[model samples]
Target chain A: MTQTIIWTVAILTVLGLLLALILFWVARRFRVEEDPRIDEVEKAMPGANCGGCGFAGCRAFADAAVKAPNLDNQYCPVGGDEVMQKVASILGLTVEKKAPQVAVVRCNGSCTARPRTNEYDGVRSCRVKAALYSGDTACSYGCVGCGDCVEACRFGALSMDPETGLPVVDEAKCTACGACAKACPKHIIELRNKGPRGMREFVSCVNRDKGPVARKACANACIGCGLCARTCQHGAITVTDNVSYIDFTKCKLCRECEAVCPSGAIHGVNFPKELDKEAVKKRIADRKAKAAAEAKKEVPNG
Target chain B: MGKLTFSMGGIHPHDSKFARERAIEQLPLPPVVYVSMAQHLGAPAKPVVAVGDRVKVGQVIAEPGGFISAFIHSPASGTVKSVAPRKDLAGNPVVHVEIAVEGDEWEPSIDRSKQLVTAIPDDKAAILDRIKACGIVGLGGATFPTHVKLSPPPGKVAECLIINGSECEPYLTSDYRIMLESPKEIVVGAAIMQKVLGGCRCVIGIEENKPEAIRSMRAAVAELGYPGIAVQTLKKRYPQGGEKQLIDAVMRRQVGSGGLPIDVGAVVQNVGTALAVYDAVQKNMPLITNVLTVTGDRIPGNLQHNYRFRIGVPLSFVVEQAGGIPDTAAKIVSGGPMMGKAVSNLDATTVKGTSAVLYLSEAATRRRPETACIRCGHCADSCPMGLEPFLLNRLYKAADLEALEKHAAQDCIECGCCLYSCPAGVPLLDNIRQAKGQVMGVIRARAAAAKAAAEAAKK
Candidate 1:
């Protein structure tokens, strides 16, 4: 028995050594010449693999970044500029600073504003609900309120307000990853610039119905009356398809259009003080009157 | 002599056909009617008439917009109030022609007499044209343009024409009522369709639960002595009225995945479509009226009705006429309980294929809380299309598109059999429907790409 054990140990050690040599040779033959900087770039990433960078994961982004000549096309919305800076420093490249953005729910059709016309009794999914029919409210172009966006959010940034029956985004936790925006079947959630001091003005309602029909459906529907467009000093506002849109790039945030909006669909968020509606209205009226007077004078001179 | 059923899976939901005995009654015309252009499948018809134009009943108001679309005729003598986008039953924006009813006058071209014209016209093209001009669609709820279905592509021969009288969905009796009331016309319609399909053998498949309909149809076929026409009894099964399911029950054939009924040498039409064909071909009457059943367990027996309603009448008006919405009603479905859409807008008017106004109580309609699947295999067993709903559901949640397509997600008939049979109360049909759509989209895109590549290679 002792001779058998000694022989078994000796044979096993020899077999193990043979296998290790084969593995070493195979690894050398199949070795891929990868840039070591890829590992560094991946280490610099937030490692969330949220796909907010439009890549499969942090590893894929690192692979692409190391291969790319420059980081012009790649961006990580979740990591923002700081992580990008780390990645750029590791790669010895520079990236243009992109303005930080946040998702904004474009619908303001709260439960009280838009009364439920019918009960939705289907799978608790916004995609399923939207595919089945319009929402419980008559305003078809509003939030489905099924918490699909909340489910999609990886950062715990979105939550449904039971009182309003609408999703509220917690700006502090939001990373503008755009997963929630993509999950919204109604296309009511949009990513916009988180402006200087986190202040921004945007048209909160996406309703394209006519004035009377929109007003009848939801109290806060944007009824393309063009009052906001006419009131804007900057040529930022335009009405298309019976819906008013404000160009963020051109908007000066004077808040004149917000005061002139009849349906209160234009929202100004993170402002230091509440808007003085009457005063702003008076200022817009005065400005319109002055413009009309100047146009009359020019006509007389011509 | 055994009762006929499909070879695969099916479920027997309680047939809550409360209004089966109700005779068809003509509903009074509403003062204003909103006729939707999207009454049939395919592209919505384009309106030919403008606001303020006077139209007579049976006059063409909207012309077919695409090859697969149907014409839209005025259901009443009225002045067009407006032609604008309006909300449909699902609250989706569809173009509508609003008209204010003035009188009961009809187009002089239409025959006002109730006489049944038995002579089968020899000209197949003329018969097809008449059917198209009259806007006759499959009233079994799919509303596919009948003209499109009758015209089979080259190299494909129709060996069997199945008239669906199964009325397999619970709480729907419009087809049953028509079979009992106008069996002769339905048989004639079948004969006409058979003639159009190159003298194919015609079989009318009715569920065993509908004994009266089956007996009446059989008697009508016998009296008419129409050659190559027979009435076949189908085993009572949910979704048996589906085009593929009915064809399977009658022809003993299975439609291949991603293939149409025509591919298997069979064509299916609803019994209701047959009646409409008789009207369109024999009387030159446009498909502007249809029989709809208003029923539910909560509805009073006397209040339940099978009304022959105009195409553009509002469901609310019909409900008001047949006793207002029941207090116990929790949900209103536009068709049968199994596959019908829940009605979201009552003010939205009825279209040509509107089958029923079902008022289900909360206890009867509410979905049970979903629990963990117990792996009982009931869903797969009951799937009439032979789909694995549990596996599909898991794959769908995982978003494994390639695996979904391999499992034939596109072949799902969306009959809700899996959902009905599942003890876990999982929303099997909902997820599978979405998966099917996604898979179909992928298949279509791949086909389009292949075609594009072939064209490029040729160039």
Candidate 2:
């Protein structure tokens, strides 16, 4: 038994030495000479491999950052300007700050204004729907109700209001990726300036199909009759190709476009001052009275 | 030869090619046509003709506004009634030249004969010029100008060219029909593309279901004795026709995240593109019309018709020719069921990118209720471009542009693969698209700023 134990020990020693020699050979022959800068830059990176920097992964981005002359436009959205500065410092380049912006769906063609016409029966895809034809609604310019915009959204910023068949974008969740814009063949779901405090006023409808056709399609389709431009006190609106476009930079969030739009094509978000419900009621009454007065005027002056 | 395939993230939807048996037929010309100017994927074309001007079929009405844009041509000889804005399929009122059709008179320069011509252009510049003059854009639903794709940007070398014959979308067999009927045209077109791309190695990729097409394509390649240009059979998968996917399958090169196929030393052309190239280089014919499948036979009342239509023909008119809407047809889509747009207006005219018009019965198109993301990464796993759709969806919900860019949400191809694969029917792509635009905007602004800084430094 004692002899057998010693023999076992000797065999074990030989096996251990063989394993050690194999390890040593592997370490020496197949060693990786990784540049320390790649590791350092990678450590500073967001490591999301989101390809926003046009690289496959964070490591690749780090390598690119090291090789590039500057981190000029290579700001990582996840990391923001602060993370970019660190990367720039490592690369001996300067980084600049950019304004944070989110995606804002301009239109508000909800179920209240935009109603369904025919039902769609195919692959429940926005792209397929958009590729096939206008959606299951009278408004060819509005959302297809198929959720292609929602499907296109990579940032979960947009959602379809099941009650409305229109997309509702969460301002805070939006990342301005433009995937939805490309996905939307109708191009109604636009990514506009988020602006300060999420208060923005822009022409929501993209339908430039003239007054009569636009009116027939959607109750709130933009007529593009230049009423919004005329109503804008700040010369910030432009009328071209039967479409009204508002310059958000120049126009303050006055919501005049919303008030003046005959079809309510212009939309607003987060108005601080509560809209006077009584005033709106009064205005509608006054407008009816004015219409009655105008009709009376149109009658022969007998 | 072994069957080849583009790797990863493709679905095999039902190939409901009910109209496959139908031979290509010419649709009766409508009394009126509204021709769109911006048919290609670039700047909107500028209208050169005015209202009240008489024009012939295939006559240029709008000129290219940019290098990437294509010129607009009249589909029929007619008197220009109104050069005004008309609602397109997407509800965008583009500049359309409204023509009151007179007759089927074509432009005098065009040879209307059905004789097959095999004259190849002598030089690369001549071929490119011919293609440009023809206004040949990708007939594969992309509408990218063929000349632009053939002519790579300066310093970028195109080592390989791929012919995309994979008609991966279900119910759309336009390319398949072309391959089966006119294999020679496709082959000649491919050879022309190879020549224009400076003799790059070319491969024709056809799906396995199309053995007849593959055999025909292979036969055409052999008889032609075109060295390096070969045919490859791909696994049938939805979106296999996608340029990136096709390139990957053929070259085994992942076009890199946020990079084009051209970046990987490959230029992928669609089967329709090859036909257009052949027409441009060999026949000197411009791209004013294409083949489209108007299918719905499986549908109770839908017509299954294969049509060769001119650009700007109204969907209403096309549907009317296909025995009108199936009395049971609920929705009229402009393309295949998988990626097609549901058009509300039949008045909207066909553009260059139109492939098929599907009138799905109510049973085929009722969208399922959208539910919460059950953390099923089907969207991510099925994404052709390798995007984390769930993560993007979350960032989009938060309006976290920084997180979106950090996650590389901008790389999404918007192919609806994520949305299609979701078991819970989550609209992952819809929300992501908005964020994508915003991120792209930020990127563009940064680029502009960098450019401005660089110019300032130079000064």
Candidate 3:
């Protein structure tokens, strides 16, 4: 019995040693050489895996950062400039700083402004509703108000406002990951520079119908009268398809376009409220006086 | 009798058909009608008439927008009040042609006589064109254009034409009324469709609960001496009228995942659609009217009505005619309770596929609180498509798109059986429905990508 036990133990030990040696040889033979800097770059990454940098994840971005000739087109939007700079230093490359962006809902057609023409009773998804037909409102271009963006946002930056029937973005929590923008079926969400002091101006209406039709559908719809575009001194605003767009890069926040907008579609948020009210009132008075003078001149001609 | 049923999973729900015995009544024309342009599944028909254009009944008011679209005809003779966006059955905004009723004068080409024209034309193309011209669609709730369904893709030969007389949905008796009242017309319609399908054998499948319909249809088939046409009685089951389920019950063939009924040499048409086809081919009449049942358990006895209403009539008007919205009604469904959509806005009007306006009381529609799943597999047993709803629900919660596709999420038919059968009151169908949409979108994107790659390779 003692001799059999000794033989069994020796044979088992030999098999274990042989397998370990083979495993070691295979590990070395098929070893893939990877850059040591990739691990450091990944460690510096925010690890959100939000895919805001057009990469699958932080590890994927790190791999590409180590292999790419230069970090020209590669930048993490979530991390802004700091993470990209760290990655660039680790990779011995350089990356240009890009302006931090936040998603902004481009529609201002509240329930009170744009009355619901019908009710949507199908799947409670904005994408599904958008695919089915126009929304409950007559303005087909407005938000469907189904909270699909809120559901898609991993950072909890969006929530549907019950009163306005629109999504509200929390700038503090928003990483400008572009998930909400991509999830928007109507293309109603846009990523723009957060602006100084979070002050931003944009045309809040997406309706492209003619003036009369647009006005009939939503009270705050852009009529494409070109008044705001003409009023912008810096040429920051342009009207196309009966809708106006504000170029944030060129906008001076002068509030001229907002004052001149007849439908109140051009909106400026986080600006000085008292100054805005005063300027708006003054603009209205000036418009009324001009119209009266023109009418008087036409009457004399008649 | 050993009744025929689909071999897969199904459920037995209470057939709350309170208005089954009531005969169909003719509803008076409303003051104004809102005829939606998108009553069918495809692209909305483009408006052919302006706001102030005078339109006669049976006149084409909107033209088909695409190959799969159907034409929209004026259901009433009136002056067009407005052509603008209006609310549909589910309260979604859809472009509608609003007309103020002036008179009920129909187009001159329509034959208004009460004679039953049993002789089907030999020209198949002419029959299909006439069906399309009349805007005939599957009235069994899926408003697929009949013309497109009749003409299957090449290499697919329809060996059997299944007539869905199985009004299996609880509280829906429009098809039953059609079968009992217009048996001759239905038989002739089936014969016409069989002729269109190259002399394919026709089978009219009705649920066993609808004995009167089966008797009447069989008698009609015998009287007409229609060759290659027969009547079948199916077991009373929820979703038995489902196109796939019905095909399985009758043909004993399972339609493969993501495949149509024609893939198995069969074409199924609703009995109402067949009746519409008869009118379209023989009488040269358009589908301007349909039968709808308006019933509620809490409603007064006299208030439950089965009306043959004209298309484009406001549902509110019909409800008011029945007894003004019942105080007990907590939810109003556009179709039967099992598959119908909740009426979010009553201002929405009826369409070509409107079969019933069901009102469920608060007690009846109340949902039980969801609890932890016990792995009971009841949902799996109840799913008519043999899908594991509980597993799908879990995968959806995990947002595992890859696993969802592997499990064939797109095969879900959105039938409420899993939800109804779950002992834990889990919303299996709801979660699965959303996941199905996501999986289908992914599949479509992948297909498009592959197509593009193939094109590039060819170049």
Candidate 4:
């Protein structure tokens, strides 16, 4: 028992000493200068090195911050104001509190609005179909069922409603990364202010064709006829080349423009309380009535 | 045959060179031609001529807008129908000068004679000036001004000049036909490019697919007894014709990411550029016409009709001449399958950079449903630029801009190699491209921010 105990102790002593030496040498050899600022700057970072700021990652940003004088335009999309405050505190510099952005799909041409006019048998890819022709549906401005956008969204923010052949943005997962926007050839996706109540207003239709041509193509295309602009109390909308652009800065989320659109082309979102609920309900009813009238026109008289 | 090329990743799609051995034939003037001003890279050349102006063949219609831009010329003796906008393959409405071609006429200085001149020129400046004045650019679709290519930036010595005879893009045999028929002129052009590059040792690289071209070019190189001009046969691969790949294949040097061929002590010029140099210097002819290949799978007898049309010939009209779109053909692309873009508008015309009009069946273009990127490494295996496309694609998805920038996403040549080789059929470039743009914007913004900071510090 004595021999066994001594042997065990001796082996333990040697192993322990070797480990201690290794740790000591490793600590010395591979030790980075440990810029005290790196950790501070890192803590201040949003931790999502999603190259929106153009550096390699949070670590790289920290390195750049310590090396360079300021983080003027390096505001993190993920970190936003809170993280920027942390970073500014760490670096003892002033930071801009910029408005955060979220992605909004501009096209609302759902199944009822933009019905499929033809069937396609090839690849189920928006990119492929987009490359091949305008679309199987009569609405050239509408989403072609293939989910290039879904594939493009890294944050799992976009999911295609298989029935509607369109994408739905899950605001929680979305980072306003703009991947889907670039992936979409139709430019039907835009980034807008998330607004105070997680609500936002946007002209969902990106179709720039004239009012008449747009109506012919898609029932809900924004004709850029400037009706939305005239109706806005805050002058939030501008019409150029027959396309209505909502200036998010001036928009008050009143949903007034949605009421005045002849083609129901204007859209409002995240309204204050029950504001414009009646307008949307009436618009939906009128659209159903118009659809019924068209259906009736197609049917033979008894 | 020397070792197969040194490019990191490349694929061998079937080289349906339907027009491989087809003789170069002149395309008779169409009723109307729509020439786009924004043909080459860089800022689009501002139009110098307006609508309804009478233009002779080879007249300068547009001048270079910037250092990288190429000059535009009248394709044929014609009156400008309209200086209007026309849709391109990408559906971008580019400013186009529509020309209603009149009867065939030759430029005053252009030697209409089919005379072969073999005398090697001595003055590099004169040769380069002729090429520059003639507005001859790279003919293999890059359309980089030949003079600019010959004029390397100072302190960067070109060690070896690569004469790219690869003509590797499938279905386009304009270069191959040029090689087979006008072998001497081609040699003279390469020699001129070599001379203009300050007498760098020249190596004419050809893909082994064209054995006859190899044999003919090898014989010509030897017969001329040129000191440095050696014909090297490379393994057949698509995009072997790319400048970086061609440089790597010939010079055995990997071009640094975001670096050009000249950065590696080499200058790679395409075969068509060589011929254009010859025309500009030897014949004093301005660049107005190019031999375009009108071919597809259903094209009868593998019909390789090589027509010399002036830039801006409507692709729809060109397709009609080659017996219109086949009833079975579903998609029309501008260029080869690998690098080509689908033309949404058939009314779009052949620009200076327009190479081949590829017709892919619906079956050829359909994407298999995209599964999660299996990390197959096939994209890496095929990336000619040796980029980690899978990682880059993932980073792009996450919008991890910094990781993407560090990964050198800016170095991506956007050659569609990664997208083509992706087993998931994931639009790898579409994702990476967005990230790349964002990262670049960040870099630019950072640089500007740093400059401002420095300026403030100075103050």
lDDT score, residue B383, model 3? Answer: 90
| CA error at residue A285 for candidate 2, angstroms | 22
Model 1 clashes, total count: 1
Error of 2 at B372 (Å): 3.4
Measured on C-alpha atoms, candidate 2 has an lDDT of: 0.78
- Candidate 3 Cα misplacement greater than 4 A, ranges: A1-24, A68-73, A89-94, A105-168, A183-189, A203-247, A257-267, A283-302
Task: Count the clashes in each prediction.
Answer: 1, 82, 3, 12
User: CAPRI band of model 1?
Assistant: medium
Worst 10 contiguous positions by lDDT, candidate 2 chain B: B296-305
Top lDDT: which candidate number? 1
The superposed Cα distance between candidate 4 and the true structure at residue B33, in angstroms, equals 1.7
B374-456: candidate 4 lDDT, tens digit per residue: 88899999988788999997787676888888899988777778888888877787666666777878988999999999999
Which parts of model 2 have CA positions greater than 4 angstroms off? Answer: A1-209, A218-302, B300-302
Q: Count clashing pairs, candidate 4.
A: 12
lDDT tens digits by residue: candidate 3, A1-302: 99999999999999999999999999999999988999999999999998878899999999998989999878888888999889988877888888888999999899999998755544577876775566787776899999999998989999999999999999999999899998898999999999989888999988877788789879999999998887777989888877889999999888878877889898888886634656765876787799899999999899
Clash tally for model 2: 82
- Per-residue CA lDDT of candidate 4, range A180-281, in tens? 887887778887888877877778887765577567667878878786786666988888867888889888876767777777767666555655647755
What's the distance in Å from true for residue B358, model 3? 1.2
DockQ winner = 1
On the 0 to 100 scale, the lDDT of residue B185 in model 1 is 96
